[model samples]
Target: MSARSQRPGFGWAAPATVFFVAFGILPIAIVAYLSLTRWNGLGSPEWAGLENWRALPDDPDALNGIKVTFLLTLLCWLIQTPVSLLLGVWSAGRQRSRAILSTVFFLPLLLSTTAIALTWLSFLDPNFGLAASLGGSSLLSSPHQALYAVAFVIAWQFVPFHTLLYQAAARQIPTSMYEDAELAGANTLRQFFAITLPQLRNTIIASSVLIVVGSLTYFESILLLTGGGPGTATRVLPLHMYIKGFVGFDMGFASALAVLLVAVGTLLSVLIVRSTGYYRMASDREGFL
Candidate 1:
């Protein structure tokens, strides 16, 4: 083909490419630029060199927020991912069962974060909530337990989404593989480890990426639940940024925190992509048994 004729279609791609460059790339570049300056969202922005990065280490609130953010992220991932996958596998094992169970699992994702938070507020009410009504202590009212309460709510809310993802991935496994494994005298557990799990590795990794990022950045659930209160026990980075920017009106430092958030999120996504072999051209079915 002639070089001129070899050009690809730009009809739909052009607009999307432009949109990304304008809204996504440009904004990220601007944020990177702003991160190095001392602009309080007014007047001229003064150059601050590495001051923000330097301050990040010593800022107690930022440090705490980072700790809380990672803690919450880790808890959600460690607990939710496996549960979702197992549920998905169990649900997908049968057609009718899958429909009913999947619906129940996914119901939480349909509710607004605020609505979910408020609903949990009542459930976790120390005085008269369902917890107390059921003769159990309300998890929300206890500072020692509030973080776990929020984490539980978050995991409960997102489990269905992950379950659905895993279900879809699991359903793609050829029945022949299961039959072959069974013929080899492999039991369910053996088939799962040697056959099923390895097949779903990519989907599992992809789902995990979504879960981790969602848990890290999503604060509405935690915000309404505890407002990062009980003495900053749950003041995650996003909450800290909100308090600093809007409550404290220190736009410069807030923006710096925002930049830090973006940096951390970006780094996390990159790490997941790298560790999961997600960015490569490998097919999802490449390693399947």
Candidate 2:
């Protein structure tokens, strides 16, 4: 048979499209409808008719949630990308010790998120955790320090995953490129800047999109760690939405926040992809091939 004759048809996408509509698009549609009605997780939803949407402009917590979410997202990118890049490049070396150490470094990604959060929660406990043992003032209880602490813990948890991405991408850089640079008397640092970073451009953009969008749903760690506590210092959008919907029983407003969350995450991912031309999956070696 001709290659074209055996190619998958449009029918191949039906299962995935149906699944996305049922679970993904359908949930968003329901939430959008819920945002227009006042539901308290009890009786039938009353027609709120933009009351929740209008209040979003004046809601202190919602606004702060947006700010904090972006702040954390930025922090994650700043903390993870460079560290991951450095470690990934280093670990890409074909050495026994590098492989062994890379395995250890990736342990965090293997652990359960709840277990990791709870472990950190205990470590940061003011009374008896490691933070107290260090004789430093309680990090988690201090509003000024808690957010930064959370960001650090987030980096600790997620950096390994991104590092793995960079490692794979780094290893794929044609050895000849580095050899050519070496022939030209380029130093390690110069070769990295000129070759590694440029070739990994696509991976960086892809990883960044994941980090920004994933930051929106960072509910469990913050929930388990601070419970949006120390007076809303670490209360990100997801936790803020949870408090409104479940704790405050303002489901309609929370639905609005969820819609906002969806909009912001989608926009951010789309913007990055569009701006960087990542959607084309452009190769750094386009002409080098």
Candidate 3:
């Protein structure tokens, strides 16, 4: 048969491609051009050479922001993933509990980030707050622990999403695998390792990537919690860029920070996909043995 006959028309794909180019590719090009220039968010963007990038390291607060951003991303993902997986597997096996637990976990995600941030801000406040009511010190005041507070809030918001993804993957597994495991006298733990996990590899990888992206881009949540901190302690890259661009009125520098944030996010996404063997799992119909 002819190639034209075999490979059909654009149809729906054409619109999607157009959308991608219009919204994605075009914006990226604009941002790329803006990053290399000095702009006040107004007049012409004058080429500033590598001035913005070179100044990044010397900006003490910005450097600290970058460090905290990476730390928070790692902490949130590490803590959230395993809990989500275990709960996902358990809840997927039960109907009523799954429904109730999924609702509970997803409720926070349904709320606006600004609302969640405000709620968390009060909860972590030193006075007249839930944390204080629980006889705990003010999380917002404690620079050492402020980032963890942000992580906790984010985890609480997103764990349900990860669990739902995991459950969906778990439910797709064949019942014969569980039956065979029982027949072989393999305990629940062994059965999970041998059957469930291997099958859920793709789901796990996908969930991790999603979580990483969420943690990286989180702004309002962190902003409200501590306003980037008592002393810039919890200022992450997004917050940093916001402050520099809007608050500091340094559009060029802000764009540079934005570029770095995107670069880091892209790099982490690549690493997560490769490390989790997402590609291999996707191509395999039966999952890993």
Candidate 4:
């Protein structure tokens, strides 16, 4: 073959390559470099070796932020996934019901995060709001209740997105399989276990990865709704990072935290993908490597 023909599609891949280099590779490289220094977002950065990284374990705020982040992730997963799956299954079974309910469920997703947070804030207000009649205690002000309340709102906004994903995946399942199960006198629950769940495995994995990664990086809504307070009760890692970088002006420490956040997110994504055997499934179906 000619040298030109044997070469890869460099011309076609140029834009994507440039974008990845500029946005992805460059930022990660910069953050990794910055993590090892002590800079206050002014003057020159002084080399601090691994001091910031070492301090992370001992830092109460960082530790609490990690705990809160994971807790929020767990709550979001528990609240959103099953409900989305159930709604997806239900909607898939009834076309007419699907149209109406899908619209209602997805409406929240169309609104901006700020708008959703503001709306929920009003609803949860202690006076003259919907929660006022329920003993009139402010949910957002109580440290114990604040995290869960914020998590619920986040879940409410995202559940429909997952539901739609599951619905699409469910629709891809062959109808004949369900018919065969029915012919054998299988009920809805039995058929679901035998057919639907197994077929939707890949979809579930994809949705879960998205949810976990998103949960880890949650910021804007939490910032607007709770401001990571009632004494740092709902302060997640991203919020902590923002406070450290912008508010405290500890650029280097925040960069270290940022790097750690990226590491944790990447590790979680990899572990979930591996455990779910997503790559193997993809390779089997599409000959992907």
Tens-digit lDDT track for model 1 on 161-222? 88888888889988888998888899999999987798888888898889788877878888
For candidate 2, write residues 174-211 as lDDT tens digits: 99988888999999999988888998899999899989
Error of 2 at 234 (Å): 0.5
TM-score of each: 0.88, 0.95, 0.91, 0.91
- CA shift at 135, candidate 2, in angstroms? 1.7
lDDT of each: 0.83, 0.92, 0.84, 0.89
In model 3, which range of ten residues has the least summed lDDT?
280-289
Model 1, CA-based lDDT = 0.83
What TM-score does candidate 3 reach? 0.91
Please write out the lDDT profile of model 3 over residues 92-158, one tens digit for every residue.
8767866876777668768887888888888777888898899878877988988888889888888
Clashing residue pairs, candidate 1?
Answer: none
After TM-score superposition, what is the CA distance of residue 126 in candidate 1 from its true location, in Å? 1.5
Off by over 4 Å in 4: 1-13, 283-289
**Collision pairs in model 4:** none
TM-score for candidate 2, please give it: 0.95
**If the candidates were sorted by their lDDT against the true structure, best first, what order would they fall in?**
2, 4, 3, 1
TM-score of 1: 0.88
lDDT at 17 for candidate 4? 93
Model 4: worst 10 consecutive residues (lDDT sum) = 280-289
Candidate 4 lDDT tens digits, 1-289: 2466777887889999999999998998998888899999889999999998898898898999999999999998888889999888777766686688778988987999999999998899889778997889889999999999999999988998999999988887878888878999999999888788878889888989999999999999999998999899999999999999999999888998999999999999999999878976652222111
